[model samples]
Target: MAKAYWIATYRSIADPDALAAYAKVSGPAIAAAGGRVLVRGTPAQVYEAGLNERTVVIEFDSVDAARAAHDSEAYQHALSLLGEGAVRDIRIVEGAEG
Candidate 1:
């Protein structure tokens, strides 16, 4: 099965506390579901036309695994913090075989 990759680009974080809240909820959720965070932070440089200021990348075993993680109760619990705090864009893509 192809691996699943999550790429998120975001900006305008008005409340760092919201990120803190997500860290508390989503960190354990990702760990519990075997997801790994490949990268999380500002990029050294972004050349894309619509690129956001911050970026995050995550990897899961397969598309199903990624879907499961997104649909999980724990992640939903984490999402409660998103409103009014920041704007985000998330994408899921299939990775190539090694």
Candidate 2:
């Protein structure tokens, strides 16, 4: 199966404490679900569209694994902490095979 990438871009953060709470749980949850965080942080620069934002990319073994990680109980707990805390766009996509 092709590898998968979980990409999340945060448009705005409304509650820093809540995001901190989410991070506490999310890392362990992602790791437990066989996910590896490849990139995470604010972009160093933006070339167009004024789209500067914090982003995260996680790698998973397969598309199904990425979906499973998002649906898993531990991640659900993390989501609960982050409810309404930020505006973000998230996607899970299969990576190109080399």
Candidate 3:
């Protein structure tokens, strides 16, 4: 099966402290679920129509694994800590076979 990627792009951050708190918990939760963070940060440069937003990409063994990680109790608690802290767009996509 193709690897899966969890991509999250933060459109806006209203509370940096809240985001930090969520990250503190979510990081461990994701690691426990077998996710490898591939990239995380604001883009170095923006192309046409691309906003300078914070983006994170995490790799998982498969789509099901990624979904499970997102739905896990630990992640849910992290989400609660991040409530209304920021606006983000998240997606899970299967990687192309080499």
Q: What is the C-alpha lDDT of each candidate?
A: 0.83, 0.96, 0.98
Better of 1 and 2 by TM-score: 2
Could you give candidate 2's per-residue lDDT for residues 1-98 as a string of tens digits? 89999999999999999999999999999999999999999989888685889999999999999999999999999999999999999999999999
lDDT of 1 at 7: 82
Candidate number achieving the greatest lDDT relative to the actual structure? 3
Candidate 1 residue runs with Cα over 4 Å from true position: 48-52
Candidate 2 weakest lDDT stretch, 10 residues: 43-52
- Compare the candidates by TM-score and give the number of the best one: 3
Instruction: Summarize candidate 1's per-residue lDDT along 1-98 as a digit string, tens digits.
Output: 88899887776787889978887888789778878999998878768585547888889998888888888998988988665678787888889999
Q: What is the TM-score of each candidate against the true structure?
A: 0.89, 0.96, 0.98
* TM-score (C-alpha) between model 3 and the true structure: 0.98
Off by over 4 Å in 2: none
Tens digits of lDDT, candidate 3, 1-98: 99999999999999999999999999999999999999999999999999999999999999999999999999999999999999999999999999
Candidate 1 clashing pairs, residues 3+ apart or interchain: none
Error of 3 at 68 (Å): 0.1
Choose 1 or 2, whichever is better by lDDT.
Answer: 2
How many collisions per candidate?
0, 0, 0
